[model samples]
Target: MLQCGVAIAAMLTVAPSMALASADSAMLPRNLSPWGMFTHADVVVQTVMIGLALASLATWTVWLAKTVELRQATAQARERMAALEGGASLAELARDCGEASDAVARLVQAAAHEASLPGASWDSDFKERIALRLERVEAAMARRVGQGTGILATVGAVAPFVGLFGTVWGIMNAFIGISQAHTTNLAVVAPGIAEALLATALGLVAAIPAVVIYNHLARVITGYRALLGDASAQLLLLLSRSKGRPAVAFGRAG
Candidate 1:
């Protein structure tokens, strides 16, 4: 009986020691793992990532919408100019192109209005005046075409550095935590580094699309500018040829 009692006492002592060791291991905080570090990262890093994602989506959406609009504008302007060059009257051209929102139509309308000005007879200088008016119309068209594209330029130029700032901030915090804990384990430093990298990746995700779309939209806007300039030149040539001639009245006998 004494031997059995001694055995029970010894087992009880061994079990408590094992439990204490397990509790200490658990209390060591899992070697300060990356997952634990990430849980403590600044909220601002997450906010920046969210913002970059939103910016990328917005830029791509705008790029798609603008491309379709510019393509349609170009095709319609081409068709309208071809009809005008085929000797269609201004009124007929306007009616045929009523559905078009191209810069060419605005120039044509401006010229028609100038021609209808009272006491402004068609003279040698009429073409010059009409050309000047067309220039103004072209400028307006350019402004319209370029609207909202500046946002892409701003975002592309700024997003990378913004991400870099987040990376730097995160790395600084990681180092500070390492210094405090006096540990170099992968678990201790990985989370902060991963959080930092996430910012840079998000920034690039936002910036690359912005840059690509900006370039594409710029080319489309350039093409529209060229089309408008060509249409204006053609209108001026027609005006020069019709100088000193009475304006042809449409839909009414003069």
Candidate 2:
């Protein structure tokens, strides 16, 4: 009778193991399983992710290209300006600039034009007009240097939440599956959770570089703006001195 009891107890333990194994097998996701949660994700979510990725790439590309162009342009402009400071005429400077449309050259041309104008005054109103022209030029330069950066800001601001949304949707789907299956089997939940996490990871990947690049480009642009402002001031000073006027008095009059 004791031996019979031992056999029955062993069978009881083995039976539960077998049942659990059957449940796991049934819940296991197939290798060919569909995209599951991702499949159910709204098209907007997918589009946001894709657009973020593309924007990030575009910003990086523009940053690299503009960095090279600006550096080269600044170097050339500085070289030409140094030569001009040593007494080269405006006509000479323009000729040397040739096909190069550097910012400094443009400023010089504008100044020369104003100086040559029949009724151009060096007084306060004239200076104000010159300042307006310079400001417009500065704005144009800023726009060129800052191209494609706004998208990065948008991505940085929105990607994390987009990822979270995707994750939440995926988790909700996983819970629904668990409820339908009436089992707490890991196989039923793990795949959905993994998919959800992947979206979040992708979102972060899209955001980090965009944020970094945007900051870097912003610094470069700020430096450029300061440099242009200084150059514009120097040009005005040159005009004042050439007209046999004191710098402070001329500036105040303008």
Q: How far is candidate 1 from the true structure (C-alpha RMSD, Å)?
A: 6.4
Off by over 4 Å in 2: 1-52, 121-128, 245-254
TM-score of 1: 0.79
Tens-digit lDDT track of model 1 for 1-254: 99999999999999976775554444344333445534556777766677777888888888877888888888877876797688766656555555445788878777776766665667777777878889999999899878889989988999998888878887887788668655665655676677777788778888988998899899888988998888988887777777667875432211
Q: Give a tens-digit lDDT track for model 2, residues 1-254.
A: 99999999999999987887788677655542335544544464455456556756766776788678768766755775575576655445545555556777667666555555665555766666666777777677667766776776887788778777867776777688778877777776787677667668767887787788778877877888777777677666665555544222211101
Worst 10 residues of 1 by lDDT: 23-32
How far is each candidate from the true structure, as Cα RMSD in Å? 6.4, 6.0
lDDT of 1: 0.76
Model 1: residue 107 alpha-carbon error in angstroms: 1.0
List candidate 1 stretches off by more than 4 Å. 1-40, 95-101, 249-254
Query: Could you estimate the TM-score for every candidate?
Result: 0.79, 0.74
Prediction 2 global C-alpha lDDT: 0.66
